[model samples]
Target: MTAQPNSTEARDMAYHLHSYTNPRKLEREGPLIIDRGEGIHVFDNSGKRYIEGMAGLWSVAVGFGEKRLVEAARRQMDKLPYYHTFSQKAHGPVVDLAEKLIGMAPVPMSKVYFANSGSEANDSAIKLVWYRSNALGRPEKKKIISRIKGYHGVTALSASLTGLPNNHRSFDLPLANILHTTCPHYRTGAEPGQDELAFSRCCAEELEALILEEGPETIAAFIGEPVMGAGGVIVPPEGYWAAIQDVLRKYDILLIADEVICGFGRTGNMFGSETFGMRPDIMTLSKQLSSSYQPIAALMINDSVYEPIANEADRIGALGHGFTASGHPVAAAVSLENLAIIEEKDLVGNVRRLAPHFLGRLNALERHPLAVEARGIGLIGALELEAADGAAAGATGARVGAILQRNGLICRNIGDSIAFCPPMIITAAEIDEMFDIVEASLGELGQQAAA
Candidate 1:
């Protein structure tokens, strides 16, 4: 039965329209209203606590209720609450954050363009790609190729770049000039005998073939996540990035690394690009940029990508694009504090030290009857459930995920893969506690299935 009317749940049902949720079901069951959070855990309105297993959508690197971040926002709000970056106007925090990001980027990044979310950053990246192509007098070079099962974002253009079917289902998406190639999930996509290297080569060949068929003149860029998140937390096969880079270089196609999920030490390194050996022409960043304390994302473009755009802007009398809150001072302030916290506390090193324990427990889950595969790197991992024979795809995993939720662990089930992305502040004991709940949930599901 649904919660009683006049309750918080009922109030939410009355007005809230949630993204990525079945509205009918939400109205019936109501929402789990989170009232407070501390460290890597959140409590519901009823005061029930659950370990945040997916780090609140693979963001929240520094965890919740971070006082420093709160103070940073307060300080910024008190000093200068709002500002716009349009028309060459800027703020100190925004400029400082940009310089800090450029200095720390894995590869040389020349300029930083701010946005409010990963979607906007990626959407802006698409605009920049087309704009740069036009500036270079190659207007036909505008098609961007992403991969199947790779997620960029949910905006019109970024959603098109996203390879997941649901994002494009009834929206008339995948708007013109967007192409999808193979996903480099060797275990899932590879033929029985094909090795990882061979499968990687095959993926690269497929991309090259697509470029050839479309004519290289029409292909502008290729975008991918260092570790595909929101798409089953897919970790690309060995040599995947190297092979893909070769094809992009051959065609002179720009590479955009969607670091929305993989930035800020999620993958043990400072950025997933460093972990995966991806040398991108542009990088889309968000999520952990401010640890989700404030909404912010940025697109970093190399000098080669920025110069033509600058020249064209000069020619056209203006750059002609920016968001009203492109670099909101409060957001920038929070992000600066977030970055400083990560550096001072060495959360990246914490992630490195705890990776073994996290991955060890993750890999150990494969022994469970429902676990088909356990794969991940750093503090992020996924346990792919083996749907029972004759059961619908993803059905079993969904049920198990629900059970895990009830048992006080909040995670995401992408198809049949249950993803675990605990906060960087999580300790080894908390990791074990998180995994313990998962194991118990799996055991319960296993019993239910046998029944």
Candidate 2:
């Protein structure tokens, strides 16, 4: 059906250029204009509600229409609408939020630097790594290694750090110094007959090989998501992080845990780093930090990563790296309140409680014919799709996504994987309902195929 003239969809087709969309198809089909949100549900313009299976992009820890966050923003905006952290100027909200993040860190952290989004936070982190390298007089130690299919962000530098091809294709990205090694998906990356342990060791060996090929003295850092999010929710095989960390230690390389999706109770723990045995020197956080209520992201550095940079800055008289909205008081305020709600309500506990049900339902999908594999941890998971009757690679997933949308669930299709990351506030009953829709959607696909 075509969009009515001057309608919201029509205007969107006429004016808006969406990200990650096929523009031509959007012009023909228009958009699903979300009107408002409450709890784990969002209503479209025509008042159709969706379960928000992806948590508004794998964030929104405390759920939507959270009144406390609104109140926090209002109070801070009224008291101090805007402030910059430049020239040693600081505000209460930013200071409090930073302190809160540092105190809540999975490992010891020295300082928290704020940014408006994950992209900027990663970009800033890379710059800091380069800065730290320069400060330590190891200017050649600047190449940062990420993993294949890892999702960092979309900025020039961060996009390069990201391991996805589309993120780099035609964007002239990956600049210089950003490299990608092996992805640790046992089913996808391992050779035939390779067990999880062997594959895990192979991943580490490949990483070390890459480091040696690049000259280990030149490798500055290795960055990764604790549980790969956009890369089809690929949970690392057993002993994966331990093996990887061993390599980094041998080379004295820093680890940058991109906790944008795995932070803030999404992964059954406060941070994915705790869930996995990752000892990162620097960490980039966003998405759930403020639950996308207000745009905010932060980077935390341990003393091992910060001291040399601090000394270097002291010698040079400045760090000279930051974003204008680094710690916007209102954003920081909402984030602080968001964290309070997560703790006071024991959202992490909720995740731990419901994760078995969530994963049970997710893993059960493997019984379906179209399911190639099922993977996940905590509250995040995905059912990978195999094309029916030799259809295109992602065709099955695309069809499943459309069916789930019509069935009142909004989830994301990353490549051929149908990801379900509902809000942490979701109940056990809600988990059943969410999977009911998913199961029915896949069943419908089967029915259509059989017919």
Candidate 3:
């Protein structure tokens, strides 16, 4: 038998495999091993503090170590630790949460379905679209369309729906029926002298063209994030969503707003769909729903989408789709408590008040030599680093990201862009501190690139 490892690094290397990590590099460097978190910062096992600029994977809205969330989990665990929302079984937390989500939905929603993660919620949405199409008697309407830079999730069908190449490579993903539309990013899509409105029209035309090429009868849904989150926080160009939704409506394509990142005050609203005027037929939500205190996700369906499915389930005598932990009592209880805290603390109002400050700080970086573009909404933002005269697309991005990490601000390096998504609970002083660190890092990187 092999001997057990003693060091944290050794144990992690022996047993842990991390997602989105370079396996070979992890074997060499091991994990940072975060010990705990408070507010918008996390401490490594060595006591090194990092301003969690990405909000613990774009969630953690209320920040870390909220006693209310902890107490809520403990209360539920004591009262009813485990209960499934399957086979006609239900629990108070689940029922209450469903009501709360429906009431809070930007658009009118008929029901809520619980899942374990954003990926699961997205996967369920895909299944629901297919089932809805089948119920409408158009079995051919199964293909789903997403944009090139949009991020849905990472499950089988959801990963297929994801527009990024890396998510699809080596995974045999984007399964069979998933189609992609043009990314509505003007900076990348623009030709010389192309106006934003023209770019918007171009995107609409491209989507319409794709739908025509695929045949509208074969397309079931169109899914997208309100602001492209993992895809470098790319906000849509002027009139982008308006035009895209027009095309989808014309073709009768169901819209699925993947609000996993943009939901829950991340975009200065309760939901991104509201901020962006995206009237989706269905919505997938996670992340801030429980402030990442516990694992939970939800799918909100409109009456147009849910009634058929409910009827089909009644006719078929079984739904046959659900995780054992779906709507787990402990998670639902924590999520309910999290929502209450968000409302009581007026976190959404805080986001609206602080967003201009955050955006001002990020926009200030535009004049920095290495910064090509600085864009964001609410607390979520990105600074795209310009490549050296002839350097590769992501070369400077890697250097800037390393510099930021060393400077104690941990942000996401998505290609040539650095993404920032501070917790909704971030104070004005902490916001200033975060920008100061980022500015220092950018200055150092700019000097290095110039040299």
Candidate 4:
């Protein structure tokens, strides 16, 4: 039903232009303005509670209404509301968070550069890659390779790094010196009779072939999500990362793990790099960094990647890179508290314990008539829908997702897949409850499709 032209809906339609949304549809149907949240659930303007299955854009790891995060923000606000880390100036929160992140890194990291969002962090990483290569007197080594369907971020450079066509179609994106490799989804991209391991080799060969075709000297880095999140929560085929990393290492290309969604125990590890054996030269983190309570993101670079940039900065007399709120004190404080809560509550261990039930319930959805496959790891999962007869791709999944939304379960539909990544704090019973709604919604969708 189209929402009535009430104050909230009317104002939203009047003043807001939402990202990744069809504005025409928003004009007709309006928005679900959430009023509040508790735990993993949010209440709409009408006070109807729904499970935030996607965890508010795949962040919110510690869950909603987390008092510790709130109090942390408040305490920081009271102490030092805002401070900038530029021109050698630093604050306690920023310094402390950096130290904590460095110590907890999956691989040894030299420094942390803070940004306000995932997009900025990724865009900055690209710039850093270019800067580093130039500093090393390899200015031609500027091209970057990302996989098809990889979701990096939406800023200019970051969106170019993103492989989704929709993000680039009208934006004149993928600006230049950017190349794409084949998606690592073995289920759909593999050759007939080829196994996953073999397909992984094929993917690596494709990367190597691309590097050769483009001239290895021109390619500076390869960035990828540890588990592709917005791109249907794709877990790469077995041996995929190892093979791909081998090729990158051979070409002397830097590897960047974009752990924006898969970080903070989402993949049952501190970072997705650990979940999958990726020793990235650089890493981008966001989403759960501050639990989305305050916008924050960061990039960590290993010594090899950092040294050139540091030298370049020394040579140039200034780094010439940073945001005004690069390391805002409040965001850093909130992030520190979020990590501490995760530690105190053993949230990572909880995700490990609860993942089996989560994945089991998710995999069981494959039996649904409309489901083509159910794929998941840790707390993240997706149900790829079978296209209805004579319908376009993603039509059935979108329809079913809309039905699920109406039934009070919020998830995201990417192409034909509906993704679910609840907060790490979710309980086993809540996992079951979330899937109960999913089963009911899918069953209804099946009946509707048949009808």
Candidate 5:
């Protein structure tokens, strides 16, 4: 049904230029206006509830309507609503968050830099990589290599680092000096007769080849998500990270782990780097950092990466790169409280406890008619569906997503895979509820297709 004129949906259609949405399509099909959220459920404008399977773009770790995060924001606003981290000025919230993040880092991070979102964090990481290279007097060591299908950010630099072609198509992006190597999805990238280990070797060899072709000294950093999220949640195969790390170590290349999606227990561990054994020199984090109650992200760097940048800053009298809201006091306070709640409630342990059931329900989708492959870890999972012949690539999955949303579970699809990453606070019963809706919705979709 078309939206009523002057309603929220129609108003949005008139005024909003939504991200990752077609403008013309909005005129035909207006947006689903979400009104409020609680725990793991959200309600649309019509008061229909949804399971929030994607956790609001895979961020809300603790879940919606987390009161502690609300109180943290309120208290901070009443106290120090805004402040800047420029020059040497700092506030308690930002200071505390930086220290806490450095302490909680998977690796030995020397310092933490604050940003507003994952994109800004990644963009800053890339800029800092370049800055550090120049600081070390190796300006030629500037090119950064990210995997194909990697989704970094929408900014010019971060979008360039992103390997998805759509991000680069009209923007004339993926600017000079950025390169893309093979993605680590062994099932898709493997040769006809190749095994998992062989596929892993091939990926590493491709990386080494790219590095050599570009001159190892000219390569500054190689960045990747431990599990590719927006690029269809592509999890790495066995022995993949080890082999890739070996190549990076051999080339003396710094690793930048884009843990925007996998951080904060979404991957069954505190950090995806711990799950994957990735020892990155720099790590970018967002999404679940503040449980999306506040828009905040962080970049952490080890001594090796930080020393030169600090020295360069000292020489130049200013580092000369930061945002006005780089460490907004209110955001930092919410983030600190969010982290505290995650720790106090042992959300990571909850993920570990529920992951088996979650993945089991997800993996069982392979038995369904529409599902071709199911891959997941912890509460984050995806289903790749077999589309009808002659249909566009994502057509079937898109329809399935629509059906699923109407069935009271909201998920995001990338190509043929419908992805789910529910809030960490969701109970075991709710897990069953979420998947129950999934199965029924897919069954409905299957029936519709058959008819």
Candidate 6:
């Protein structure tokens, strides 16, 4: 055992600045330094192993320590370490990856622009929408709308596009033209006797009203996640996307599908756009593109959106926008190889076959004392804990999450909901193991609540 640090916890507290974390709480609790991973499991510094339930923040589609991906990165690094796609410059790997992405797009996509992360991809998407609207002589159509619980990304415009309160509070976000409508969660948002179809209509009506209230001419785009990931794994009500798309079409507003989390077989589809019947004018892709083996992302746009943006760029001398590491050759190569592996191994098929089993097991937890709701689609699921004695649910979700960590499972707590997004490579037996631990933890929590 590599001589454990004398004051490792204190050292982490002193040096690291974590994202989306309570800094003070981090100072007190310290970091849980993960050492390495194999397959769908990761090991900590103490050699304790735990299933990577959230796929390392909902990326890592191929799981960890994938040798083929590592080899792809190495081969690309040796041949052409790095290159930029700016100022008309490009490389083979980047070009090939872009072609593959455009070809694989669920809807007909005219172009693919590369970026370094989901946030950057989404931020670029926002800029493209505004630029395209301006090029078409609709500068007033600069406002973007997203759902209240929908998560886009964390950069300036993207964060504004994100509808979560925490992403906006004290940051002065939602930056002027961004607007958020209602979250279409039937279990939580539905009125008495309101069925899924009724809830879907309500969502559509509410969205149309918002557009009218703001004047549809002011709205340029509407962005959404097909299956809400960070905001409690909210799968939309039936007919939700169809109704929402009708509203967008009626107003001539573009739809931007933020597939950062659900892309690349998470929902048993190549893209969530296909699964949810979303024909987005623009789509953002990341997370599973390189299976978290490399830091990369892509923004795909259809001909309608791309043609205007391209024409505008020609008129402006240059787009004047790009990241230094956009389409990095090494990342692109690895991403291509990752996609090949996903296809070769029939990972999407696995997800489709296993989804019903996973959902069945998760739904069984609904009647548990600590579980108020059990919701999931494909491999992503959540168990929402109810408040004890009417106190407040989700308040204790994080505490329960910590307990789950102690019980040898690693998942996420999103506002009183315990989210599970195991890697797509996880087997049926492993699924049983994961939920067994979850059941144990819930049982303990239930006993504690009763006491």
Worst 10 residues of 5 by lDDT: 2-11
RMSD of each: 1.9, 2.0, 1.4, 2.2, 2.0, 2.5
Better of 1 and 6 by lDDT: 1
Model 6 vs. true fold: TM: 0.97
Candidate 3's TM-score reads 0.97
In candidate 4, what are the lDDT values of residues 213-247, reduced to their tens digit? 99999999999999999889899989999999999
lDDT of 2 at 39: 95
In candidate 1, which residue ranges exceed 4 Å CA deviation? Answer: 1-5
Query: Residue 238 lDDT in model 3?
Result: 84
Give a tens-digit lDDT track for model 1, residues 89-140.
8999999999999999999999999999999999999999999999999999
TM for every model, in the order presented, reads 0.98, 0.98, 0.97, 0.98, 0.98, 0.97
Per-residue lDDT of candidate 2, residues 167-196 (tens digit): 999999889999999999999788999999
Evaluated at residue 350, the lDDT of candidate 2 is: 95
Superposition TM-score, candidate 2 onto the true structure = 0.98
lDDT of 2: 0.93
- Collision pairs in model 1: none
TM-score of 5: 0.98
RMSD of 3: 1.4
State the C-alpha lDDT per candidate.
Answer: 0.93, 0.93, 0.91, 0.93, 0.92, 0.91
| Candidate 1: residue 36 lDDT (0-100) | 93
Regions of model 2 farther than 4 Å from truth:
1-5
Error of 4 at 124 (Å): 0.5
Model 3 lDDT tens row, 327-438: 9899999999999988999999999999999999999999987788998998899999888778887778877888888889989899899999999999899999999999
lDDT of 6: 0.91
Considering summed lDDT, which 10 consecutive residues are worst modelled in model 4? 1-10
Q: Residue-wise lDDT of candidate 5 within 1-451, one digit each (tens)? A: 9765688887898788999887998889889999999999999988999999999989998989988889999999999899999989999999999999898998899999999999999999989999999999999999999999999999999999999989999899989999999988877899999998899999999999989988999999999999999999999988899999999999889999999999999998999999989999999999999988888899999999999999999999999999999989999999999999999999999999999999999999899977889998888889999988899999988898899988999999898799999999989999999989989988898788879
